[model samples]
Target: MTEKQREEAEWESINVLLTTHGLKPLCLVKRTDLKDLIIFDKQSSQRMRQNLTTLVEETSRQQSMIQELIETNQQLKKELQLEKCRVVDQEQRANDLEQILESVKSKVSELEDESLNRVCQQQNKIKDLQKEHTALQAKCQYYKKKRLEQEETIAFLQKDIYRLKKEEEERIVTQNRVFSYLCKRVPHTVLDRQLLCLIDYYESKIRKLHKQRYD
Candidate 1:
Protein backbone atom coordinates (compact mmCIF):
# COMPACT_ATOMS: atom_id res chain seq x y z
CA MET A 1 0.00 0.00 0.00
CA THR A 2 2.51 2.64 -1.09
CA GLU A 3 0.98 6.03 -1.88
CA LYS A 4 2.00 7.83 -5.12
CA GLN A 5 2.70 11.65 -4.84
CA ARG A 6 2.60 14.13 -7.70
CA GLU A 7 4.81 17.32 -7.86
CA GLU A 8 3.19 20.77 -7.34
CA ALA A 9 3.65 21.77 -11.00
CA GLU A 10 1.99 18.59 -12.26
CA TRP A 11 -0.86 19.00 -9.74
CA GLU A 12 -1.44 22.60 -10.76
CA SER A 13 -1.49 21.70 -14.45
CA ILE A 14 -4.08 18.91 -13.83
CA ASN A 15 -6.24 21.37 -11.89
CA VAL A 16 -6.06 23.97 -14.63
CA LEU A 17 -7.05 21.42 -17.31
CA LEU A 18 -10.04 20.18 -15.22
CA THR A 19 -11.34 23.74 -14.64
CA THR A 20 -10.90 24.84 -18.22
CA HIS A 21 -12.59 21.91 -20.05
CA GLY A 22 -14.04 19.66 -17.28
CA LEU A 23 -11.67 16.73 -18.19
CA LYS A 24 -9.47 14.84 -15.70
CA PRO A 25 -5.88 14.30 -16.75
CA LEU A 26 -4.60 10.68 -16.29
CA CYS A 27 -1.01 11.46 -17.34
CA LEU A 28 1.04 14.19 -19.11
CA VAL A 29 2.23 13.12 -22.53
CA LYS A 30 6.02 12.53 -22.74
CA ARG A 31 7.35 14.66 -25.70
CA THR A 32 10.60 16.61 -26.09
CA ASP A 33 8.87 19.80 -27.26
CA LEU A 34 5.55 19.33 -25.36
CA LYS A 35 6.21 18.96 -21.59
CA ASP A 36 2.57 19.55 -20.52
CA LEU A 37 0.30 18.04 -23.19
CA ILE A 38 -3.06 17.63 -21.46
CA ILE A 39 -6.09 15.99 -23.18
CA PHE A 40 -9.09 18.39 -22.93
CA ASP A 41 -11.22 17.07 -25.79
CA LYS A 42 -14.24 15.05 -24.64
CA GLN A 43 -13.66 11.87 -26.79
CA SER A 44 -9.93 11.62 -25.90
CA SER A 45 -10.65 12.28 -22.21
CA GLN A 46 -13.20 9.45 -22.06
CA ARG A 47 -10.85 7.05 -23.87
CA MET A 48 -7.99 7.84 -21.44
CA ARG A 49 -10.30 7.39 -18.46
CA GLN A 50 -11.38 3.95 -19.72
CA ASN A 51 -7.71 2.87 -20.31
CA LEU A 52 -6.72 4.03 -16.75
CA THR A 53 -9.61 2.14 -15.17
CA THR A 54 -8.66 -1.04 -17.05
CA LEU A 55 -5.03 -0.72 -15.89
CA VAL A 56 -6.15 -0.36 -12.23
CA GLU A 57 -8.31 -3.51 -12.47
CA GLU A 58 -5.49 -5.51 -14.09
CA THR A 59 -3.04 -4.38 -11.33
CA SER A 60 -5.47 -5.49 -8.61
CA ARG A 61 -5.85 -8.95 -10.22
CA GLN A 62 -2.07 -9.37 -10.57
CA GLN A 63 -1.57 -8.51 -6.84
CA SER A 64 -4.14 -11.16 -5.80
CA MET A 65 -2.44 -13.81 -8.01
CA ILE A 66 0.97 -12.95 -6.48
CA GLN A 67 -0.44 -13.43 -2.94
CA GLU A 68 -1.86 -16.88 -3.85
CA LEU A 69 1.53 -17.93 -5.33
CA ILE A 70 3.29 -16.90 -2.07
CA GLU A 71 0.90 -19.08 0.07
CA THR A 72 1.36 -22.15 -2.20
CA ASN A 73 5.13 -21.82 -1.99
CA GLN A 74 4.97 -21.82 1.86
CA GLN A 75 2.80 -24.98 1.86
CA LEU A 76 5.28 -26.74 -0.47
CA LYS A 77 8.14 -25.89 1.92
CA LYS A 78 6.25 -27.50 4.86
CA GLU A 79 5.58 -30.69 2.88
CA LEU A 80 9.25 -30.96 1.89
CA GLN A 81 10.30 -30.73 5.58
CA LEU A 82 7.92 -33.57 6.52
CA GLU A 83 9.28 -35.74 3.70
CA LYS A 84 12.81 -35.17 5.02
CA CYS A 85 11.80 -36.36 8.52
CA ARG A 86 10.18 -39.48 7.09
CA VAL A 87 13.31 -40.35 5.15
CA VAL A 88 15.42 -39.99 8.30
CA ASP A 89 13.12 -42.33 10.25
CA GLN A 90 13.30 -44.95 7.53
CA GLU A 91 17.10 -44.81 7.47
CA GLN A 92 17.28 -45.34 11.26
CA ARG A 93 15.03 -48.40 10.98
CA ALA A 94 17.28 -49.85 8.28
CA ASN A 95 20.36 -49.40 10.51
CA ASP A 96 18.64 -51.26 13.36
CA LEU A 97 17.75 -54.15 11.08
CA GLU A 98 21.36 -54.42 9.90
CA GLN A 99 22.61 -54.61 13.52
CA ILE A 100 20.10 -57.35 14.31
CA LEU A 101 21.20 -59.35 11.29
CA GLU A 102 24.87 -59.14 12.35
CA SER A 103 24.00 -60.23 15.89
CA VAL A 104 22.10 -63.25 14.58
CA LYS A 105 25.04 -64.24 12.40
CA SER A 106 27.43 -64.04 15.37
CA LYS A 107 25.15 -66.20 17.53
CA VAL A 108 24.84 -68.75 14.76
CA SER A 109 28.63 -68.99 14.51
CA GLU A 110 28.94 -69.55 18.25
CA LEU A 111 26.32 -72.28 18.17
CA GLU A 112 28.08 -74.03 15.32
CA ASP A 113 31.37 -74.00 17.21
CA GLU A 114 29.68 -75.40 20.33
CA SER A 115 28.09 -78.18 18.31
CA LEU A 116 31.43 -79.16 16.80
CA ASN A 117 33.11 -79.20 20.22
CA ARG A 118 30.40 -81.45 21.62
CA VAL A 119 30.75 -83.82 18.70
CA CYS A 120 34.51 -84.09 19.26
CA GLN A 121 34.04 -84.81 22.97
CA GLN A 122 31.49 -87.52 22.19
CA GLN A 123 33.87 -89.16 19.74
CA ASN A 124 36.62 -89.26 22.37
CA LYS A 125 34.26 -90.75 24.93
CA ILE A 126 33.23 -93.44 22.46
CA LYS A 127 36.88 -94.31 21.83
CA ASP A 128 37.54 -94.68 25.55
CA LEU A 129 34.49 -96.92 25.92
CA GLN A 130 35.70 -99.13 23.08
CA LYS A 131 39.09 -99.54 24.71
CA GLU A 132 37.44 -100.44 28.03
CA HIS A 133 35.28 -103.03 26.27
CA THR A 134 38.37 -104.63 24.69
CA ALA A 135 40.11 -104.84 28.06
CA LEU A 136 37.03 -106.45 29.65
CA GLN A 137 36.90 -109.08 26.89
CA ALA A 138 40.55 -110.04 27.49
CA LYS A 139 40.01 -110.33 31.25
CA CYS A 140 37.01 -112.59 30.68
CA GLN A 141 39.11 -114.86 28.47
CA TYR A 142 41.83 -115.15 31.15
CA TYR A 143 39.30 -116.07 33.86
CA LYS A 144 37.85 -118.77 31.56
CA LYS A 145 41.28 -120.35 31.14
CA LYS A 146 41.79 -120.52 34.96
CA ARG A 147 38.34 -122.11 35.42
CA LEU A 148 39.22 -124.90 32.93
CA GLU A 149 42.48 -125.64 34.77
CA GLN A 150 40.60 -126.02 38.08
CA GLU A 151 38.11 -128.41 36.44
CA GLU A 152 40.95 -130.63 35.19
CA THR A 153 42.46 -130.81 38.66
CA ILE A 154 39.11 -131.84 40.17
CA ALA A 155 38.75 -134.74 37.63
CA PHE A 156 42.23 -136.07 38.43
CA LEU A 157 41.51 -136.08 42.17
CA GLN A 158 38.20 -137.95 41.62
CA LYS A 159 39.96 -140.70 39.60
CA ASP A 160 42.61 -141.17 42.30
CA ILE A 161 39.89 -141.54 44.98
CA TYR A 162 38.14 -144.31 42.96
CA ARG A 163 41.38 -146.28 42.56
CA LEU A 164 42.12 -146.14 46.34
CA LYS A 165 38.58 -147.41 47.14
CA LYS A 166 39.02 -150.42 44.78
CA GLU A 167 42.39 -151.31 46.31
CA GLU A 168 40.93 -151.18 49.89
CA GLU A 169 38.11 -153.59 48.90
CA GLU A 170 40.58 -156.12 47.36
CA ARG A 171 42.81 -156.08 50.49
CA ILE A 172 39.79 -156.76 52.74
CA VAL A 173 38.75 -159.80 50.60
CA THR A 174 42.28 -161.33 50.77
CA GLN A 175 42.38 -160.95 54.60
CA ASN A 176 39.07 -162.78 55.03
CA ARG A 177 40.18 -165.67 52.79
CA VAL A 178 43.46 -166.14 54.74
CA PHE A 179 41.68 -166.10 58.10
CA SER A 180 39.20 -168.86 56.97
CA TYR A 181 42.03 -171.06 55.63
CA LEU A 182 43.92 -170.76 58.97
CA CYS A 183 40.84 -171.82 60.94
CA LYS A 184 40.25 -174.89 58.73
CA ARG A 185 43.82 -176.24 58.12
CA VAL A 186 45.55 -175.75 61.51
CA PRO A 187 47.00 -179.10 63.16
CA HIS A 188 44.82 -180.47 66.01
CA THR A 189 47.90 -181.60 68.03
CA VAL A 190 49.68 -178.17 67.81
CA LEU A 191 49.70 -176.04 71.09
CA ASP A 192 47.30 -173.04 71.09
CA ARG A 193 50.15 -170.56 71.81
CA GLN A 194 52.30 -171.96 68.97
CA LEU A 195 49.35 -171.78 66.55
CA LEU A 196 48.62 -168.16 67.53
CA CYS A 197 52.27 -167.19 67.02
CA LEU A 198 52.28 -168.77 63.51
CA ILE A 199 49.09 -166.84 62.57
CA ASP A 200 50.66 -163.50 63.65
CA TYR A 201 53.85 -164.28 61.60
CA TYR A 202 51.76 -165.05 58.46
CA GLU A 203 49.82 -161.76 58.92
CA SER A 204 53.12 -159.85 59.15
CA LYS A 205 54.43 -161.51 55.94
CA ILE A 206 51.16 -160.69 54.03
CA ARG A 207 51.44 -157.01 55.11
CA LYS A 208 55.07 -156.92 53.83
CA LEU A 209 54.00 -158.41 50.43
CA HIS A 210 51.18 -155.89 50.09
CA LYS A 211 53.60 -153.01 50.87
CA GLN A 212 56.09 -154.29 48.25
CA ARG A 213 53.38 -154.50 45.62
CA TYR A 214 52.43 -150.86 46.35
CA ASP A 215 56.11 -149.75 46.12
Candidate 2:
Protein backbone atom coordinates (compact mmCIF):
# COMPACT_ATOMS: atom_id res chain seq x y z
CA MET A 1 0.00 0.00 0.00
CA THR A 2 0.97 3.62 -0.47
CA GLU A 3 1.93 5.78 2.64
CA LYS A 4 -1.11 8.19 2.23
CA GLN A 5 -3.56 5.29 2.03
CA ARG A 6 -1.99 3.67 4.97
CA GLU A 7 -2.20 6.92 6.92
CA GLU A 8 -5.89 7.35 5.94
CA ALA A 9 -6.65 3.78 7.02
CA GLU A 10 -5.00 4.27 10.42
CA TRP A 11 -7.02 7.55 11.05
CA GLU A 12 -10.27 5.75 10.23
CA SER A 13 -9.32 2.87 12.59
CA ILE A 14 -8.52 5.28 15.44
CA ASN A 15 -11.88 7.11 14.89
CA VAL A 16 -13.74 3.77 14.95
CA LEU A 17 -11.89 2.69 18.11
CA LEU A 18 -12.66 6.04 19.80
CA THR A 19 -16.35 5.77 18.82
CA THR A 20 -16.58 2.22 20.19
CA HIS A 21 -14.92 3.23 23.48
CA GLY A 22 -17.35 6.16 23.94
CA LEU A 23 -14.78 8.91 23.33
CA LYS A 24 -14.62 11.83 20.81
CA PRO A 25 -12.43 11.45 17.69
CA LEU A 26 -9.14 13.30 17.50
CA CYS A 27 -9.62 16.51 15.45
CA LEU A 28 -6.64 17.63 13.38
CA VAL A 29 -4.12 16.63 16.11
CA LYS A 30 -0.54 15.63 15.10
CA ARG A 31 0.99 12.19 15.81
CA THR A 32 3.71 13.83 17.93
CA ASP A 33 1.09 15.53 20.19
CA LEU A 34 -0.73 12.15 20.57
CA LYS A 35 2.51 10.47 21.59
CA ASP A 36 3.24 13.18 24.17
CA LEU A 37 -0.30 12.88 25.59
CA ILE A 38 0.03 9.04 25.85
CA ILE A 39 3.32 9.43 27.73
CA PHE A 40 1.77 12.00 30.17
CA ASP A 41 -1.25 9.71 30.77
CA LYS A 42 1.08 6.75 31.54
CA GLN A 43 3.10 8.88 34.03
CA SER A 44 -0.08 10.09 35.74
CA SER A 45 -1.41 6.50 36.00
CA GLN A 46 1.92 5.32 37.55
CA ARG A 47 1.79 8.16 40.14
CA MET A 48 -1.82 7.33 41.02
CA ARG A 49 -0.92 3.63 41.54
CA GLN A 50 1.99 4.57 43.85
CA ASN A 51 -0.30 6.98 45.88
CA LEU A 52 -2.99 4.18 46.18
CA THR A 53 -0.37 1.71 47.54
CA THR A 54 0.83 4.27 50.17
CA LEU A 55 -2.79 5.06 51.18
CA VAL A 56 -3.54 1.31 51.63
CA GLU A 57 -0.50 0.88 53.92
CA GLU A 58 -1.50 3.93 56.01
CA THR A 59 -5.09 2.56 56.41
CA SER A 60 -3.74 -0.84 57.58
CA ARG A 61 -1.53 0.85 60.20
CA GLN A 62 -4.48 2.95 61.44
CA GLN A 63 -6.64 -0.20 61.82
CA SER A 64 -3.90 -1.92 63.84
CA MET A 65 -3.62 1.09 66.16
CA ILE A 66 -7.39 1.14 66.65
CA GLN A 67 -7.35 -2.56 67.64
CA GLU A 68 -4.60 -1.93 70.24
CA LEU A 69 -6.57 1.03 71.69
CA ILE A 70 -9.67 -1.22 72.09
CA GLU A 71 -7.62 -3.85 74.02
CA THR A 72 -6.13 -1.16 76.30
CA ASN A 73 -9.63 0.22 77.02
CA GLN A 74 -10.83 -3.27 78.04
CA GLN A 75 -7.90 -3.70 80.47
CA LEU A 76 -8.58 -0.27 81.95
CA LYS A 77 -12.22 -1.19 82.51
CA LYS A 78 -11.23 -4.35 84.45
CA GLU A 79 -8.81 -2.38 86.64
CA LEU A 80 -11.47 0.23 87.35
CA GLN A 81 -13.87 -2.48 88.47
CA LEU A 82 -11.26 -3.89 90.89
CA GLU A 83 -10.56 -0.45 92.27
CA LYS A 84 -14.25 0.11 92.88
CA CYS A 85 -14.46 -3.12 94.84
CA ARG A 86 -11.46 -2.14 96.94
CA VAL A 87 -13.00 1.27 97.67
CA VAL A 88 -16.23 -0.40 98.80
CA ASP A 89 -14.31 -2.72 101.12
CA GLN A 90 -12.44 0.21 102.65
CA GLU A 91 -15.72 2.09 103.18
CA GLN A 92 -17.20 -0.91 104.98
CA ARG A 93 -14.19 -1.10 107.27
CA ALA A 94 -14.49 2.58 108.01
CA ASN A 95 -18.16 2.13 108.91
CA ASP A 96 -17.33 -0.76 111.23
CA LEU A 97 -14.68 1.32 112.96
CA GLU A 98 -17.13 4.18 113.39
CA GLN A 99 -19.60 1.82 115.05
CA ILE A 100 -16.92 0.49 117.39
CA LEU A 101 -15.92 4.01 118.31
CA GLU A 102 -19.52 4.83 119.13
CA SER A 103 -19.82 1.76 121.31
CA VAL A 104 -16.65 2.65 123.18
CA LYS A 105 -17.87 6.16 123.73
CA SER A 106 -21.17 4.89 125.07
CA LYS A 107 -19.43 2.51 127.45
CA VAL A 108 -17.15 5.26 128.69
CA SER A 109 -20.12 7.52 129.28
CA GLU A 110 -21.90 4.82 131.26
CA LEU A 111 -18.81 4.16 133.34
CA GLU A 112 -18.44 7.85 134.05
CA ASP A 113 -22.04 8.05 135.18
CA GLU A 114 -21.64 4.99 137.39
CA SER A 115 -18.47 6.39 138.94
CA LEU A 116 -20.10 9.73 139.57
CA ASN A 117 -23.06 8.04 141.24
CA ARG A 118 -20.75 5.96 143.40
CA VAL A 119 -18.78 9.00 144.42
CA CYS A 120 -21.98 10.80 145.36
CA GLN A 121 -23.20 7.83 147.40
CA GLN A 122 -19.87 7.57 149.18
CA GLN A 123 -19.91 11.25 150.01
CA ASN A 124 -23.42 10.97 151.39
CA LYS A 125 -22.46 8.01 153.55
CA ILE A 126 -19.45 9.90 154.86
CA LYS A 127 -21.60 12.88 155.74
CA ASP A 128 -24.02 10.66 157.66
CA LEU A 129 -21.19 8.98 159.52
CA GLN A 130 -19.69 12.32 160.48
CA LYS A 131 -23.01 13.52 161.84
CA GLU A 132 -23.40 10.36 163.89
CA HIS A 133 -19.86 10.71 165.17
CA THR A 134 -20.55 14.28 166.28
CA ALA A 135 -23.65 13.21 168.13
CA LEU A 136 -21.81 10.29 169.78
CA GLN A 137 -18.98 12.63 170.83
CA ALA A 138 -21.46 14.94 172.48
CA LYS A 139 -23.06 12.03 174.35
CA CYS A 140 -19.65 10.78 175.45
CA GLN A 141 -18.77 14.22 176.82
CA TYR A 142 -22.04 14.39 178.77
CA TYR A 143 -21.52 10.91 180.18
CA LYS A 144 -17.92 11.69 181.16
CA LYS A 145 -19.06 14.80 183.07
CA LYS A 146 -21.75 12.82 184.88
CA ARG A 147 -19.27 10.08 185.80
CA LEU A 148 -16.78 12.59 187.23
CA GLU A 149 -19.47 14.29 189.32
CA GLN A 150 -20.70 10.94 190.64
CA GLU A 151 -17.12 9.92 191.54
CA GLU A 152 -16.56 13.15 193.51
CA THR A 153 -19.84 12.70 195.37
CA ILE A 154 -18.97 9.05 196.17
CA ALA A 155 -15.58 10.11 197.63
CA PHE A 156 -17.17 12.77 199.80
CA LEU A 157 -19.80 10.31 201.03
CA GLN A 158 -17.13 7.68 201.87
CA LYS A 159 -15.16 10.22 203.97
CA ASP A 160 -18.26 11.34 205.84
CA ILE A 161 -19.25 7.72 206.63
CA TYR A 162 -15.78 6.97 207.99
CA ARG A 163 -15.85 9.99 210.35
CA LEU A 164 -19.35 9.13 211.47
CA LYS A 165 -18.33 5.55 212.27
CA LYS A 166 -15.34 6.78 214.40
CA GLU A 167 -17.51 9.22 216.34
CA GLU A 168 -20.14 6.52 217.05
CA GLU A 169 -17.55 4.08 218.34
CA GLU A 170 -16.09 6.59 220.85
CA ARG A 171 -19.54 7.74 221.99
CA ILE A 172 -20.64 4.11 222.57
CA VAL A 173 -17.55 3.37 224.79
CA THR A 174 -18.05 6.52 226.96
CA GLN A 175 -21.79 5.76 227.41
CA ASN A 176 -21.08 2.22 228.49
CA ARG A 177 -18.57 3.39 231.16
CA VAL A 178 -20.96 6.04 232.50
CA PHE A 179 -23.83 3.55 232.67
CA SER A 180 -21.67 1.20 234.69
CA TYR A 181 -20.71 3.96 237.15
CA LEU A 182 -24.38 4.99 237.43
CA CYS A 183 -25.34 1.46 238.17
CA LYS A 184 -22.99 1.52 241.14
CA ARG A 185 -23.51 5.14 242.51
CA VAL A 186 -26.88 6.51 241.15
CA PRO A 187 -30.52 5.44 241.40
CA HIS A 188 -32.03 3.25 238.61
CA THR A 189 -34.72 5.83 237.49
CA VAL A 190 -32.13 8.67 237.03
CA LEU A 191 -29.80 6.36 235.05
CA ASP A 192 -32.59 5.20 232.79
CA ARG A 193 -33.76 8.76 231.97
CA GLN A 194 -30.19 9.96 231.14
CA LEU A 195 -29.57 6.94 228.92
CA LEU A 196 -32.84 7.49 227.03
CA CYS A 197 -32.00 11.18 226.26
CA LEU A 198 -28.52 10.19 224.94
CA ILE A 199 -30.05 7.40 222.84
CA ASP A 200 -32.59 9.77 221.21
CA TYR A 201 -29.85 12.33 220.39
CA TYR A 202 -27.68 9.63 218.77
CA GLU A 203 -30.59 8.32 216.66
CA SER A 204 -31.35 11.84 215.34
CA LYS A 205 -27.66 12.33 214.26
CA ILE A 206 -27.70 8.99 212.42
CA ARG A 207 -30.85 9.94 210.53
CA LYS A 208 -29.31 13.30 209.44
CA LEU A 209 -26.11 11.57 208.20
CA HIS A 210 -28.12 9.02 206.18
CA LYS A 211 -30.14 11.86 204.53
CA GLN A 212 -26.92 13.77 203.58
CA ARG A 213 -25.29 10.67 202.06
CA TYR A 214 -28.36 9.87 199.89
CA ASP A 215 -28.87 13.47 198.66
Candidate 3:
Protein backbone atom coordinates (compact mmCIF):
# COMPACT_ATOMS: atom_id res chain seq x y z
CA MET A 1 0.00 0.00 0.00
CA THR A 2 1.04 3.62 -0.51
CA GLU A 3 2.40 5.54 2.51
CA LYS A 4 -0.69 7.72 2.64
CA GLN A 5 -2.96 4.71 2.53
CA ARG A 6 -0.92 2.96 5.23
CA GLU A 7 -1.03 6.10 7.44
CA GLU A 8 -4.80 6.38 6.99
CA ALA A 9 -5.22 2.69 7.84
CA GLU A 10 -3.10 3.12 10.99
CA TRP A 11 -5.21 6.09 12.11
CA GLU A 12 -8.43 4.15 11.47
CA SER A 13 -7.05 1.15 13.41
CA ILE A 14 -6.15 3.40 16.36
CA ASN A 15 -9.69 4.95 16.41
CA VAL A 16 -11.29 1.48 16.20
CA LEU A 17 -9.13 0.16 19.08
CA LEU A 18 -10.05 3.13 21.29
CA THR A 19 -13.76 2.65 20.52
CA THR A 20 -13.74 -1.17 20.96
CA HIS A 21 -12.01 -0.92 24.37
CA GLY A 22 -14.44 1.79 25.61
CA LEU A 23 -11.52 4.18 26.21
CA LYS A 24 -13.58 7.23 25.21
CA PRO A 25 -15.00 9.44 28.04
CA LEU A 26 -18.54 8.73 26.79
CA CYS A 27 -18.11 5.01 27.72
CA LEU A 28 -17.65 3.78 31.36
CA VAL A 29 -14.66 1.54 32.15
CA LYS A 30 -13.14 -0.04 35.30
CA ARG A 31 -10.02 1.72 36.73
CA THR A 32 -7.79 -1.24 35.74
CA ASP A 33 -9.17 -1.20 32.21
CA LEU A 34 -8.65 2.57 32.06
CA LYS A 35 -4.98 2.23 33.04
CA ASP A 36 -4.47 -0.41 30.35
CA LEU A 37 -6.06 1.97 27.84
CA ILE A 38 -3.73 4.78 28.91
CA ILE A 39 -0.64 2.58 28.46
CA PHE A 40 -1.86 1.35 25.11
CA ASP A 41 -2.52 4.95 23.93
CA LYS A 42 0.99 6.03 25.03
CA GLN A 43 2.64 3.11 23.21
CA SER A 44 0.52 3.83 20.13
CA SER A 45 1.63 7.50 20.20
CA GLN A 46 5.29 6.45 20.43
CA ARG A 47 4.86 4.06 17.51
CA MET A 48 3.17 6.81 15.46
CA ARG A 49 6.07 9.20 16.20
CA GLN A 50 8.57 6.57 15.03
CA ASN A 51 6.51 6.06 11.84
CA LEU A 52 6.49 9.81 11.22
CA THR A 53 10.28 9.98 11.60
CA THR A 54 10.74 7.06 9.15
CA LEU A 55 8.37 8.75 6.67
CA VAL A 56 10.33 12.00 6.92
CA GLU A 57 13.61 10.18 6.35
CA GLU A 58 12.21 8.35 3.34
CA THR A 59 10.85 11.61 1.93
CA SER A 60 14.25 13.32 2.36
CA ARG A 61 16.01 10.44 0.60
CA GLN A 62 13.54 10.57 -2.30
CA GLN A 63 14.03 14.31 -2.64
CA SER A 64 17.79 13.84 -2.85
CA MET A 65 17.39 11.11 -5.44
CA ILE A 66 15.14 13.34 -7.55
CA GLN A 67 17.64 16.21 -7.40
CA GLU A 68 20.44 13.89 -8.49
CA LEU A 69 18.32 12.64 -11.40
CA ILE A 70 17.71 16.18 -12.54
CA GLU A 71 21.40 16.99 -12.43
CA THR A 72 22.25 13.84 -14.35
CA ASN A 73 19.63 14.62 -16.99
CA GLN A 74 21.08 18.07 -17.46
CA GLN A 75 24.55 16.61 -17.82
CA LEU A 76 23.29 14.14 -20.41
CA LYS A 77 21.72 16.96 -22.37
CA LYS A 78 25.01 18.84 -22.38
CA GLU A 79 26.79 15.75 -23.59
CA LEU A 80 24.24 15.37 -26.37
CA GLN A 81 24.97 18.90 -27.46
CA LEU A 82 28.64 18.12 -27.60
CA GLU A 83 27.94 15.01 -29.62
CA LYS A 84 25.91 17.04 -32.09
CA CYS A 85 28.78 19.50 -32.50
CA ARG A 86 31.20 16.67 -33.09
CA VAL A 87 28.90 15.17 -35.70
CA VAL A 88 28.67 18.49 -37.49
CA ASP A 89 32.44 18.81 -37.51
CA GLN A 90 32.81 15.33 -38.88
CA GLU A 91 30.33 16.06 -41.66
CA GLN A 92 32.28 19.17 -42.59
CA ARG A 93 35.49 17.19 -42.73
CA ALA A 94 33.82 14.58 -44.90
CA ASN A 95 32.65 17.29 -47.28
CA ASP A 96 36.13 18.76 -47.43
CA LEU A 97 37.55 15.33 -48.16
CA GLU A 98 35.02 14.88 -50.95
CA GLN A 99 36.07 18.18 -52.50
CA ILE A 100 39.71 17.20 -52.29
CA LEU A 101 38.96 13.82 -53.80
CA GLU A 102 37.13 15.44 -56.69
CA SER A 103 40.07 17.77 -57.30
CA VAL A 104 42.45 14.82 -57.29
CA LYS A 105 40.21 12.95 -59.74
CA SER A 106 40.15 15.92 -62.07
CA LYS A 107 43.91 16.19 -61.91
CA VAL A 108 44.28 12.46 -62.59
CA SER A 109 42.00 12.75 -65.62
CA GLU A 110 44.03 15.68 -66.96
CA LEU A 111 47.26 13.77 -66.41
CA GLU A 112 45.87 10.74 -68.17
CA ASP A 113 44.80 12.83 -71.15
CA GLU A 114 48.21 14.50 -71.30
CA SER A 115 49.94 11.11 -71.06
CA LEU A 116 47.79 9.75 -73.94
CA ASN A 117 48.62 12.80 -76.05
CA ARG A 118 52.32 12.36 -75.29
CA VAL A 119 52.11 8.68 -76.25
CA CYS A 120 50.46 9.57 -79.57
CA GLN A 121 53.09 12.21 -80.28
CA GLN A 122 55.86 9.74 -79.39
CA GLN A 123 54.33 7.10 -81.69
CA ASN A 124 54.27 9.58 -84.57
CA LYS A 125 57.92 10.51 -83.79
CA ILE A 126 58.80 6.77 -83.79
CA LYS A 127 57.18 6.40 -87.22
CA ASP A 128 59.16 9.42 -88.53
CA LEU A 129 62.37 7.97 -87.00
CA GLN A 130 61.74 4.62 -88.66
CA LYS A 131 61.31 6.33 -92.05
CA GLU A 132 64.52 8.36 -91.51
CA HIS A 133 66.40 5.21 -90.45
CA THR A 134 65.23 3.51 -93.66
CA ALA A 135 66.38 6.48 -95.66
CA LEU A 136 69.76 6.45 -93.82
CA GLN A 137 70.05 2.71 -94.48
CA ALA A 138 69.50 3.40 -98.16
CA LYS A 139 72.27 6.05 -97.91
CA CYS A 140 74.47 3.31 -96.26
CA GLN A 141 76.57 5.80 -94.29
CA TYR A 142 74.67 6.76 -90.97
CA TYR A 143 72.33 3.76 -90.59
CA LYS A 144 73.96 2.56 -87.32
CA LYS A 145 73.83 6.05 -85.76
CA LYS A 146 70.13 6.58 -86.66
CA ARG A 147 69.22 3.18 -85.22
CA LEU A 148 71.01 4.01 -81.92
CA GLU A 149 69.12 7.35 -81.62
CA GLN A 150 65.76 5.67 -82.29
CA GLU A 151 66.46 3.09 -79.54
CA GLU A 152 67.27 5.91 -77.02
CA THR A 153 64.05 7.77 -77.91
CA ILE A 154 62.01 4.56 -77.39
CA ALA A 155 63.70 3.98 -73.97
CA PHE A 156 62.92 7.58 -72.85
CA LEU A 157 59.22 7.23 -73.76
CA GLN A 158 59.08 3.94 -71.79
CA LYS A 159 60.61 5.65 -68.72
CA ASP A 160 58.07 8.49 -68.93
CA ILE A 161 55.16 6.01 -69.08
CA TYR A 162 56.58 4.12 -66.06
CA ARG A 163 56.91 7.36 -64.08
CA LEU A 164 53.35 8.39 -64.90
CA LYS A 165 52.06 4.99 -63.80
CA LYS A 166 53.86 5.28 -60.44
CA GLU A 167 52.45 8.75 -59.89
CA GLU A 168 48.93 7.51 -60.62
CA GLU A 169 49.37 4.64 -58.14
CA GLU A 170 50.45 7.07 -55.40
CA ARG A 171 47.43 9.27 -56.06
CA ILE A 172 45.15 6.25 -55.81
CA VAL A 173 46.66 5.32 -52.45
CA THR A 174 46.19 8.85 -51.13
CA GLN A 175 42.56 8.93 -52.29
CA ASN A 176 41.89 5.59 -50.59
CA ARG A 177 43.32 6.88 -47.29
CA VAL A 178 41.13 9.96 -47.45
CA PHE A 179 38.06 7.87 -48.22
CA SER A 180 38.75 5.55 -45.28
CA TYR A 181 39.22 8.42 -42.91
CA LEU A 182 36.03 10.12 -43.98
CA CYS A 183 33.91 6.97 -43.87
CA LYS A 184 34.77 6.07 -40.30
CA ARG A 185 31.65 6.20 -38.06
CA VAL A 186 33.30 7.62 -34.97
CA PRO A 187 35.74 10.47 -34.63
CA HIS A 188 38.93 9.75 -32.71
CA THR A 189 39.03 12.54 -30.16
CA VAL A 190 38.91 13.28 -26.47
CA LEU A 191 35.59 15.00 -26.98
CA ASP A 192 34.05 11.76 -28.23
CA ARG A 193 35.38 9.86 -25.24
CA GLN A 194 34.10 12.47 -22.85
CA LEU A 195 30.66 12.38 -24.47
CA LEU A 196 30.52 8.62 -24.26
CA CYS A 197 31.51 8.66 -20.62
CA LEU A 198 28.87 11.24 -19.84
CA ILE A 199 26.20 9.18 -21.55
CA ASP A 200 27.19 6.12 -19.54
CA TYR A 201 27.19 8.07 -16.32
CA TYR A 202 23.75 9.48 -16.98
CA GLU A 203 22.39 6.09 -17.95
CA SER A 204 23.60 4.66 -14.66
CA LYS A 205 22.08 7.56 -12.82
CA ILE A 206 18.73 6.92 -14.49
CA ARG A 207 18.85 3.29 -13.38
CA LYS A 208 19.63 4.35 -9.85
CA LEU A 209 16.70 6.73 -9.93
CA HIS A 210 14.41 3.93 -10.95
CA LYS A 211 15.71 1.76 -8.12
CA GLN A 212 15.21 4.55 -5.63
CA ARG A 213 11.70 5.19 -6.79
CA TYR A 214 10.78 1.54 -6.42
CA ASP A 215 12.49 1.17 -3.08
Q: Pick the candidate with the highest TM-score.
A: 2
How well is each residue in 1-215 modelled by candidate 2, as lDDT tens digits?
75654665676696577567554444432355353232224544554465556557767888888888889888889999989999999999999999999999999999999999999999999999999999999999999999999999999999989988987776665555566665654325875767846865766688789989999
Rate residue 205 of model 2 by lDDT. 86
Stretches of candidate 2 off by over 4 Å are 1-71, 175-215
Minimum summed lDDT over a 10-residue window in model 1 is located at 1-10
> All models: lDDT?
0.70, 0.73, 0.69
Clashing residue pairs in candidate 1 (N, C-alpha, C atoms within 3 angstroms) = none
- Count of backbone clashes, every candidate in sequence: 0, 0, 0
* Predicted structure 2: clash tally: 0
lDDT of 1 at 113: 100
| Candidate 2 structure, TM-score to reference | 0.55
Rank by TM-score (best first)? 2, 1, 3
| TM-score-superior candidate, 1 or 2 | 2
State which candidate, 2 or 3, has the greater TM-score. Answer: 2
> lDDT-based ranking, best first?
2, 1, 3
